[model samples]
Target: MVSRRGTKSKTPGSKRTSANPPSRKQFNPSLHRFQERYEQKEFQAKPHGIPVRVLSFMGVTVLAMSMYSGYLYASYQREVSKAQSLDVPRDVSDRYNSTAPTFDAEVELSEKAMRLGKKRGDLIRLARGDVLEVSCGTGRNLEYYDLGERRGTDDQGHAAVIGCRSLTFVDLSPQMVDITREKFQAANPEFTHVAFRAQDAGAVTVEAPARVRDLAGAGKDASDHRAYYDTIVQTMGLCSMADPVGTLRHLGEITEPERGRILLLEHGRSHYDWLNRILDNLAPLHADKHGCWWNRDIGAIVEESGLEVVEVKRWHFGTTWRYVLRPKILCGEKK
Candidate 1:
């Protein structure tokens, strides 16, 4: 029994009701039949995360790889110490020619993962006056340059406003050179002082522009201005070289004796022995597939090259090397 709106009906066990009561939900036979039931479920006691067998397999795999790496590490290290010229399975040029088309794609993810662009910019921004890039694969360092004629210091540490300049790129792989030319020319059609050559950088030469020749003192009549490069760059090149030391020496010969710099970003033996071991173990297989003998000690190569080290930086457990080198004459030994 309930009380009416205005008149209170005093029934013995009566209750008051609202004028507008909530409507009751209508029952449906189908919904009631399929309604959720709440009951205690058996707790799954199965171990979470990776299965025990899978974990065991993974441990075994790691142990096997480590054992394998340890076994080969010493022998491979000895072989790299020898620095054999023909250790790589294929000649550098032919290897790169076959791989040129897919080269950028192949390296794109790795380059980004390694953050090589910033490292590249750190070196390329220092390029001023006439520039020559050897092993200029796909012109990967193109966007990093502080391009155009600009004022910068010379090799002897003197501030000089050098004359007309040029940017020349050379590589042994003709296909790679063609690809580099296409990318750069398409991007900078207005810039005219650029040359992309597919040739041996160790023996190749580039004629200097009038202003560059004058700045370098090549004289008005000197037909070959080969030694006019103010900045020489190479990245990831030494690994593929038959004689990396000799090649670096040739680069030193062409660079300006007073103010030229050789900027190199290379991968090689690590400062840590364990890492060097890994690099050594992977060396032969990596070379056969990629044409890169990546375990050479870059410090030894540079020392043997006869170039004076201006600055040196290493990254990735000392496996990556960045060197700013100059001709030995810049050390100021009186002739």
Candidate 2:
């Protein structure tokens, strides 16, 4: 015990009273655990988010690329298939030998025609179903014929010709057909299904009588009719024909009654007075240089051939006048 005096203090041997140590605040175990988990979660989440996002984007890109590749492959295959199946008649060699135009000049002119035709967009819009392309020349218009995009299905899902088929190319010049076949084959291997026939546009009866006979032999079934074409396309062919009007009439007669649509791209008489005068003056020289007669009014001939004109567009390149005509009977009526 210590004395009570203010300065007395404890006895010399007595132990001094120690100050109490500050009590430690108890730690919250649950809060510490929560903080540890949050930090761990943040660390883990940072690594996963970037990879997940990158992987997702990569997946989308790969899918898009795959789809595009498939589309290109299909298109290429179609073209190649068309080329392999193309048939050029033996008569083509003789014709090419006899009256073949200058290759360079023909190519240049054809390129010009294709460029102009593409701008019109009528060719692309008009080609559908069982298409018959007359004077098809090397199947340059095959790109315009959309074959892979047909909708719906048959009982067997094996596309119907009338409702699902694409373009058929026909030409009088066997050489022309062969060249076209090769070109398309090189470009689109899959489209080999497109048929190419060497035959006269004006005299279809004389050209492919065997095919016609075979069809007649097949009897008068609707399937046989479906096997026939639903549309006719004439491109720069009528001018060279012996009888343009008669040929148009014949085509009209053979087309499927109510479904036939005729799309014509022909160069003919100019309506422009000045241009017509120039054509008239150059007629003899033009005919001698390029076996093409500029005086025929192809539009008038088509109108008179019992085909109702659906649309008529005129294009003038230099002195040449071209007409794009869509012909059909009113209300899908048969001619």
Candidate 3:
């Protein structure tokens, strides 16, 4: 009782003092400063204000697009370069020599020409007797010739002149000539008059005046025998010639005076201005790819070859042209 009255009563709230106790006010101030510093560091680190994943994805997408575009541009440049290179000049004779063996390929394309429409039918209608089919591959058009007349006997064992008397199939390739011979033989085993020759069209000529006179059955010189071919049928053949214009001129020289007809089925310059423009633009590429020279205007060249264009008809809106040309001065005839 005496102690309680003298000393302060001991309680839970009573303040206790320690020699090494932490200072509350100072501790709180230090903690607040640490928190503010941490926030400042975080704000400084996040400068871009975008998520790292989103930025990385965008960067990769841009890089891929750039690479793809570059590849496409490079490919286009390569093709253009190739096209330009084909623009270099090549001699017509050299081109013909290089392309002569490609007749096999041309034959397949000629078959497609049959489907070109009424122009083909019109051409076949104009074809007739003692036919000399140049570039006759596999004898595809030989059936059109009159076999009875060619054989001098009809199916009824009657002699006839209405049928072809002779069919001379000529081509540049021996393989093509052999194939044509077999096809004709198989078709007409009894017809022994069919002949096949592997010869160049540009080289067809009587060697001397005696040979020409014998061939003509006339007392004419080799120059007089220049007018020999009754009719010249050219179907998709001129384009493949080394010098198409020169070839036409030679054909004109060989054709019979006024009697012979030079019939042609050719694909040439487009009539439509827009189409021609496009063709001209793509000529280099097309020629390089196909080994064809689209730059040559066949019609213009043919006309320049002393051929009188009797008819010039455009087939299929300008994809092809069919012409019937007569020589300006027929051989053995005065101009």
The TM-score of predicted model 2 comes to 0.55
- Predicted candidate 2 versus true structure: per-residue lDDT over 1-335, tens digit per residue: 44666576757798876699878999999999999999999897675545778899999999999999999878756654554454432122233323443443565686576475474254555555666778776555655665653565544776544232545677777877777677667777875446677887765532221123234444444335233456777776665565678778877766655445677777777777776665555544444444455556776787787766666667664333334343455763423
Residue 38's lDDT in candidate 1: 19
Tens-place lDDT digits, model 3, residues 1-335: 23656975667787888889785754678889999999999998776778889999999999999999999878867766676676544333233334445645764676576465355556755544545666554455655554544335534777633455456677666776787788788879997655678777766652211112233344545354342555566666665566777778877776654555678877767768877765665567755444455556777888688888888787655767788877786467542
Worst 10 residues of 3 by lDDT: 206-215
Question: Candidate 3's error at 21, in angstroms?
Answer: 99
- Candidate 1 residue-wise lDDT, 228-290, digit = tens: 688889999988887788899988887877778899999999889988877776676677667
What's every prediction's RMSD, in angstroms?
Answer: 12.6, 19.1, 18.7
Tell how far residue 210 is off in model 2, in angstroms: 15
Please, what is the TM-score per model? 0.68, 0.55, 0.57
Highest lDDT: which candidate?
A: 1
